[model samples]
Target: TLQPDVFGLVEAARILCEDGFAVFPYTTDDLIVAERLLAAGCKVLMPWCAPIGSALGPINIMALRSMRGYFPGVPLIVDA
Candidate 1:
């Protein structure tokens, strides 16, 4: 289940676990996958607002907060 996608979600998650952070120049629209990652002790850093080359904002603060709640120790960064 590692390297979940060609974009390297699992690898990025691994690196994040090891390095405390990992950046992937792409987007993941699958919230379930993100939740799974969070459940696996990996922070799901994803965008909830806008799209690539758009303004940054928290489209769903509640969802972000919920994600945070799911992973109390994991850090989720929303980079639009």
Candidate 2:
């Protein structure tokens, strides 16, 4: 029952980063969310290949590729 508060994520990440914590956000396969997380000072990104517990691997390879293209230097981990 521990769900992410998506709306407050950026601000929370910002705060954690400012306090010298490394923020690794678990994100969906969305470039915009990745961008925002990066902007908010996330050190690494954990983007899901599919919905949690779906067992479908790399469902959106294009989106993962896009994230790599957009953030070549940032570390991206495939989740779910």
Candidate 3:
């Protein structure tokens, strides 16, 4: 399903929010996923700059900057 993966993340975020904990969603530069996480009450975001263990680290600097622009002062970690 086109929405299954997002649904799972949202559900998990909801559960974490319900438990009174902030969520740190790690998006693979997916705006939809990031938006869903935000809607699910995630306070911080950790978007990946590159695939895990890839020689390339942070392939998209603009994307990272854009993500940070969404929420200034919010801790947006760039996980490689």
Who wins the TM-score comparison?
2
The C-alpha RMSD of each candidate to the native structure, in angstroms, is: 6.0, 2.1, 3.6
Q: Write the per-residue lDDT of candidate 1 for residues 1-80, one digit (tens) a residue.
A: 21136246655565666666544323344456666555444634554444545455556667667666765664556665
Flag clash pairs in model 3. Answer: none
Error of 2 at 76 (Å): 0.5
Backbone clashes (count) for model 2: 0
Error of 2 at 48 (Å): 0.8
Ranking the candidates on TM-score from highest down gives 2, 3, 1
Write candidate 3's Cα lDDT for 1-80 as tens digits. Answer: 22225667788988999899987876666767787787788988778888766768769888887777776866777787
Clash pairs, candidate 1, are: none
Clashes of 3: 0
By TM-score, is 1 or 3 better? 3
The global C-alpha lDDT for each of the candidates, from Candidate 1 onward, is 0.53, 0.79, 0.75
**Per-candidate TM vs. native?**
0.47, 0.83, 0.77
Please report how far candidate 2 places residue 21 from its true position, in Å.
Answer: 0.7
Two-way TM-score contest, 1 vs 2, winner = 2
